[model samples]
Target: MTALSLEERFRTGDPRALARAITLAESGLDAARPLLRAARELAAARGAAGTVVLGVTGSPGSGKSTLTDALISHLRSEGKRVAVLAVDPSSPYSGGAILGDRIRMLRHHGDSGVFVRSLASRGALGGLSARTMQVLALLEGAGFDWVILETVGVGQSEVDVAAACDHTLLVVTPAGGDGVQAFKAGIMEIADVIAVNKADLPGADRTVRELLAAQGLGAHDASTWFAPVRRTVAAKGEGIGPLVEAVLAHRAYLGAGGLHARRAARAEFEVRTLVQERVLRRARELSGDLYARVARGELDADAAADALLAGA
Candidate 1:
């Protein structure tokens, strides 16, 4: 129960210890600082630097959860330890994760090599929980061979997963005009691999062609990594092997230098986000009358924000 013992258990990959550490990280308490620091150090010492952190994202009804479940099975079959962080929309009243993903992945519950945790987005703009990065570091430190991040259904601007993971897998469906939507400027650009799930449905081939055409329209050259569009019927576990192969191919393309660059970008994003969160919290605490002034039209919004920051 002591901090040192907890860290020791965590180093040994104790499941309970990992769970406790993640809860502390999610709490955002000052007490979590040393634990998180130790995790980072342990990860580096263990040579877990090559651990793949895969991000799965898409709009609602895209079968992301089902695809993730298949991935977990495939990875586990290969004798690899895998951890999944499923980010779900927060409940308005309780501000807790809906737990839908956990329920769907119940078959993996007793597997020692598989760890799945659901996180509440808590109003984060990018469909990811603010504590996701820290928790991901803990998972890496816990020695999982792979870490999968499944984001809440995302839109064009909710592509933060690109900065948070080694590779971003954008999932789309064959029906519902998702093919056109997937080619939009923002989300499409971030995808390292795109999965057209529900391939058994109508328009599957058309969707594939549209996605391939969209790739052609992008400003990609021979040196650029073009996202591969693969079709899958995740519910039946069909086409998952090729999807996994595509992901690994993308990883191979990234190479060592490119992977390091992506991790560096992820580190920068975490630092900036933490700084912005702290500053906003401080500003909120000090804006007793500034909000009233703005509401009363006594001070303009921009000026009030400046004053709040100054005080913070």
Candidate 2:
């Protein structure tokens, strides 16, 4: 038996190849550099702009996975190939993800048109993995109609999804404390689309009302988008269409130039993160046992950082 090449499987839209690409992407291996370049090349050749990337984020147990499953059903019914990149928590020591997100999406199993994959956060913050952007390039190039990024546990101060996505859906529920905290966590500015999931519960309407008010106050710029808060009973598949419609409408709202600007901005963010990672790696290389010294309070962090930068 012969092994398949990345190009062969990629051209055929093989999910196995896509999974392999994502693994290599996350590994940060030296050879992964060319894989990144190859992904970019293929994405450009395929005119990857046809794919839309939507990010979903909210507090844990906010029904994010359920909403994602519902949205996948909605998108696939319309004859679209949908892929989900669910970023979940990773074991601190082993770096292996429990992958509960994909577990929640088990209903989509054996469906070729729907690709559900979970990537471990592996200590990466901002609710997304560092390699996610690269994987999106591969997914878009492979011809997925929609790539939904379900971010890590979103709570107070996890606005990282704001940078990684073209459009973001901040999922909030009709629950008690979360509804109030949502407003404080910088959600008003981050959410392009607001999904109030579990709308079947009591107080759903009130949550919507308050979210609308928050949008008003948080609109800081008159030109900024006022996110629409849609009610969704995701477990029952209710309001998924409207939610999907809201996402597409947001895309339409971002005309070609708006879309292009978003892509460019996201690309710039990825590049900046990569450069920072490299610089940090070089700093660690030069620092030797400085981490121990800092930990023991023998050397102050600012001084250690200055020494590291001086060497760089």
Candidate 3:
């Protein structure tokens, strides 16, 4: 249909319109600018200050997808309309999501209140699609009470999710050596809530202790938010209640002022990232000959970069 009709339908929270809007958004900033502008205006008009955007990230094999599935079930049970943006690694050849949406989250297939979409990371080092923030705005404008961003779980570089969501959940498994690795990766510092999934396994209690000890190492005052470490057997839906409660508590801790600050930071990040992307695109367009010159030793790498920027 026409763009105006699509925007109208999206304003009414039509699921089909939301899906189409996300697809258009993924295309690129220029292709989706009008629609995204509309979404931003709608969100501002609605004063969607309480919208919950949760970012779930962790190392690979941390049961992140299963945890997300369980989270969807819990939120749905609580009568919240939820939308999930699952970022999967891109297939090198096809540039498509390697793990498609249909394969996971199968039970929510027919749920009108829930929307699940898989995005190809497209080789983004941050483990999220380049256009993820734009698509999230569309979801928010479409009236989803909660939006969940499940990243590619690429260990060290997955920290970008913290800037994109209101709260970040880091999932780890017992006996997986995650305590040390997460510390080294700096993911621990970014997590607002930590979940030890597969808690029924051996060494679960030890893992919990290790996390608590790690938290102790960081200096904190009365105002500090000590990220709660919760145990969960997500596959069996065990301990999901406490995990959900922890997230809600964290949200409460943020309050309206804190949430607004975080959202403002996110908007700044989004704008900065878009500017960088556009500049890089322009650099690539102008640097073809500069690259050849550098390869031929006719110009130094730094000089080539200077020329590129000058041209930009």
Q: What is the TM-score of each candidate against the true structure?
A: 0.90, 0.85, 0.89
Better of 1 and 2 by TM-score: 1
Model 3 pairs in collision: none
Could you give candidate 1's per-residue lDDT for residues 266-304 as a string of tens digits?
A: 778778778777777787688788888899999999998
The superposed Cα distance between candidate 2 and the true structure at residue 307, in angstroms, equals 2.8
What is the lDDT of every predicted structure here? 0.80, 0.75, 0.79
Q: What is the lDDT of residue 62 in candidate 3?
A: 88
Using lDDT as the measure, the top candidate is: 1
Best by TM-score: 1
TM-score of 2: 0.85
Once model 2 is optimally superposed onto the true structure by TM-score, how far is the C-alpha of residue 260 displaced, in angstroms?
Answer: 1.3
The parts of candidate 2 lying over 4 Å away from their true place are 1-5, 12-16, 41-49, 89-98, 123-127, 155-157, 219-222, 283-300, 310-312
RMSD for each of the candidates = 2.7, 3.3, 2.9
Query: Residue 112 CA error for candidate 2 (Å)?
Result: 0.8
Residue pairs clashing, model 2 = none
Please give the ranking of all candidate structures by lDDT, highest first, separated by commas.
Answer: 1, 3, 2
Model 3 residue 14 CA deviation (Å) reads 1.6
